[model samples]
Target: MFIISLTYKTSLENVERYIPGHNLFLQKYYDSGQFIASGRKEPRTGGIIIANAQSMNEAEQIISEDPFYIHQIAEYEITEFIPTKYNENFKIFIED
Candidate 1:
């Protein structure tokens, strides 16, 4: 899995302008089963996305399709991790 962390590079106004398109991009990935979960940060500075891509390159390629990335409205930091232990309900997202 990959954790994509987005930090606003411009202003909130700039970020808001691309939200609609960003949402659409998110939906596309969700429909394809690439995205697991996503939402805004606590202070609303940016957002986070959990993705189930096969590799770092795949994750980056997926993120490249995001509107926020296209407009350079935010900077993305991707962290890859393996799920050692998770809730039974969340097992569907984990691959052995």
Candidate 2:
């Protein structure tokens, strides 16, 4: 599933505060092979995370760990995506 997370900043400090949690969460997912792809949205806006998980419950577990959730720094739209024809070479970015 692909989870697209967005943030509405009440203050820049809130955004800063949320960084730690986001970093930790991303590290966990990326390290665990759950994150297929992720990056900051354009104009340095929002977050886009592509995840592969066993179930929605597992996905939620990943979401709950994000720093944005801890600081209330962003809002997210978590959705389940069925990739019809994902380009393996173009889309895949697995760093070892």
Best of the candidates, TM-score: 1
Give the per-residue lDDT of model 1 (tens digit) for 1-96: 999999999999989999999999999999998899999998999999999999999999988988899999999999999999999998988964
Model 1: weakest 10-residue lDDT segment is: 87-96
TM-score against truth, every candidate: 0.96, 0.77
What TM-score would candidate 1 get against the native?
0.96
> In candidate 2, residue 7 scores what lDDT?
59
- Candidate 2 pairs with clashing backbones: 21-67, 22-67
lDDT of 1 at 18: 96
Candidate 2 lDDT tens digits, 1-96: 667677556666657766776788888888988887787877766778888876788887778777786566777788877666756673554322
**Clash count for each candidate, listed in order shown:** 0, 2
Spell out the clash pairs found in candidate 1. Answer: none
Q: Which ten residues in a row have the lowest lDDT in candidate 2?
A: 87-96
Q: After TM-score superposition, what is the CA distance of residue 89 in candidate 1 from its true location, in Å? A: 0.6
Give me the runs in candidate 1 sitting further than 4 Å from their true place.
none
